[model samples]
Target: MRRPLAEQLPSTLVAALSSAFGVCLLETTGVLAQVLAADSVTGSSATVAALLQVVASVFIVIAVYVGSIVTANTFATIIAGRTRTIALYRLIGSSASDQRRAVAREGLVVGAVGSVIGAVLGTAITIGLVSVSVATGVVPSHPYSYLGPVIALPIVAVVLTTWLASWIGSRRVLQVSPMQATGGAVEKSLDEAAGGRGRSVVAVVFFALGGALLVLGMVIGLVSPLGVLVGVVGGLLSFTGLVLGSPLVMPVALRLTGRMFGRSAPARLAAENAVRYPERSSRTTIGLVIGVTLVTMFAVCVESYQVIITNAQRAQPEVYQGVDRTLTVTVVVFSVLMGFSALIAAVGMVNNLSMSVLQRTRELGLLRALGFTARQVRTMILAESAQLTVAAVLVGLVLGTFYGWAGAQSLLGSITGSPGIVLPAIPLALLAILAVAAAVLTLVASVAPSRRATRIAPVAALAVE
Candidate 1:
């Protein structure tokens, strides 16, 4: 009655990579700040260092937040896959709480292992980079200690967050009745999802409140840049509301996007499969939404900022030239940092897709038994991936563009005297690239699942309980 370590590897890898990325980012920022502050000629070097530290902190938060969500979803899917095993345990007199506690313990162990590995890897990377920089005279040679108590921040944070996320994800265990031991695992139907009207109502309330706050922030922007802070809070609340109501939202979005593909048998089946279980589909795509939204938000904000600066530079080239250069560097740095979150989300998407395929073995097998060819099954899965990615990308782009514009307007409206009147400056090149990336991502993500689906013998897969 033991779970193989391999079953937990995805979540563990996510935790490790997230923690390692955090540590590396922190150390790099710290070292850069130290080098700058060491320059005797730059009087404001200390202040600049403080600002860099703050930016790095924001990046770390984004990474941790994305990583936590991915870890939670991974655990949730794992629990769902183990429904029958858990039910059997329940039949043998095991309590749900005990089983959940055992899962939590497993999570703790996974977190501990990952955090340690990440911390070591991050430290080594930082040391290597610092040594190279010093040797090449890129940075002022100084005795910088990569080993510090500060490193513990990411380690502890990853460990605790992973543990907490696992606990939340395992909530499904409570719903696993011993009676399910006699039946196969199942997901909530559309009707069941719709029956949760209370949750939907709460989601609406939060969303409305957040929308109100966003409007207020825009109005306040007419007077001061501080309004952006309010806008940030509003964005968070509204997004949380969206996430809570995703079961209601993502399916409709998927349906609309699914129509973009030809209505062939495989395509139709793929579309239906995606919406058949709202919870599963919603969770699978939401991570991509978050990733796309964040990346696009930053891109739009930067573009808008550049546009405003360019106009000002035309008026006073000398004064704004340095500012323009600084802005460019800042955007590049932030974009790279934001990429970490996107990567984490990408990992979640791949993990979920893989698990969804694995869990649907019987369903896939049944299709094959019903005269569906392996090629048809593979096509159906690939189509599903394409539709999901398209839906997520579209949603993310819209939300990100709006949020990015709002952020820019809230910050720069006072200077431009336009507040919410300014149009968003979306770079066409970026949009094209995203479109290409989404396509490539879909193909890449679906390959393994499609292959696995095709290779499984119909009789063997159908025999799985």
Candidate 2:
């Protein structure tokens, strides 16, 4: 049965309300209890309120980083698939303003859906964690300040922030030219191939510069918060080189490893395709690399931080906690960092694969003309994603596992510390499986775009030239 938009809206609003209430309630429980302990209505109410607000803000920011990237990439591909629809509207006398309105309408839908779900999930997680905290006496249980400034003001602010972020990030809908709409642009020919030496050069140079600055920031302890910003940006920029630089490196790397791909026909085909448009492929690869590096770097930093705190704890108990709480915090923090990183990587995989699928639309059309079923063509595209996920994940797991182990041993094995656990096979395997599954899910997201590409008739594709 089909559901009306109005019906959906009410449920969505109900969901949103439940989400807003729970989000404020669970996260603010600890500090809210403190405020209540201080009576929550005293002159210091304002001060305690601010402290609780800060904690909520921090968690919201984490949600933003983790949630935003996946939403952006997913939305981008969906909207890109709409270029033809948008172009048609323009041709039929719709102004750019009209086109933008359509884009905005779509953006609102996506933003609302994502934010509401995120809020609900975030709230549920907060409640579970807080319940555990209270039971463990990590935080005292008391009534929370949920009625006043604590709930009303911040909920409004968070909703606005979420809607704005999604809207802004999905603004690429405005960039499609009406002339490109007729669906041809989505499946254009090799002769019309784009992205030049300039992009490659820029990516490579940025890669070098980002690396230099990142190393410099690390050396200097990033004297300012600006340093952290620079390191993150620099880390992202390095992928410009790593991805664009892939063809140059990949061919050689693959020449040594090409036979590995030959173990399977699909792998052999996927590898050839990966190298076919090395420049574009590298751009896609660059995105994944950015995600992987950010995650791996942050993962290393977090573990290192814990090791330092733990070693200090080993020497003196009173200096720290009644017991080692750092380990618990470290796991949560590292897991959060990796989840965000892996998500970006997953999105990167989706973005690159969608573009690749689009680029090969004509090929799929031709295959269809030659009697291949639409599902079969879609399978080929999925195969490409599967192959890339396998290859990228294998490399990432090997390197990340080694780096994690080495970093832990160096930081935790000294007299100042007891040797913390290294990359135990179980946890490492779990994370690896999670990363692979995430990459596959990302590939699945592009299924619609791939099917859309396959829908193009061979005649139209050939005419697309």
Per-residue error (Å), model 2, residue 206 = 4.1
**In every candidate, how many clashes are there?**
0, 0
Candidate 2 accuracy as TM-score = 0.60
Residues 290-353 of candidate 1: C-alpha lDDT, one tens digit per residue: 8788778878887887776566567656544345334544454445545654675577678777
Error of 2 at 299 (Å): 4.1
Question: Scored by Cα lDDT, where does model 2 land?
Answer: 0.49
lDDT by residue (126-156, candidate 2, tens digit) is 5565567668865446554333333333334
As for candidate 2, its clashing pairs are none
User: Each prediction's TM-score against the native?
Assistant: 0.85, 0.60
174 Cα displacement, candidate 2 (Å): 7.1
lDDT of each structure? 0.74, 0.49
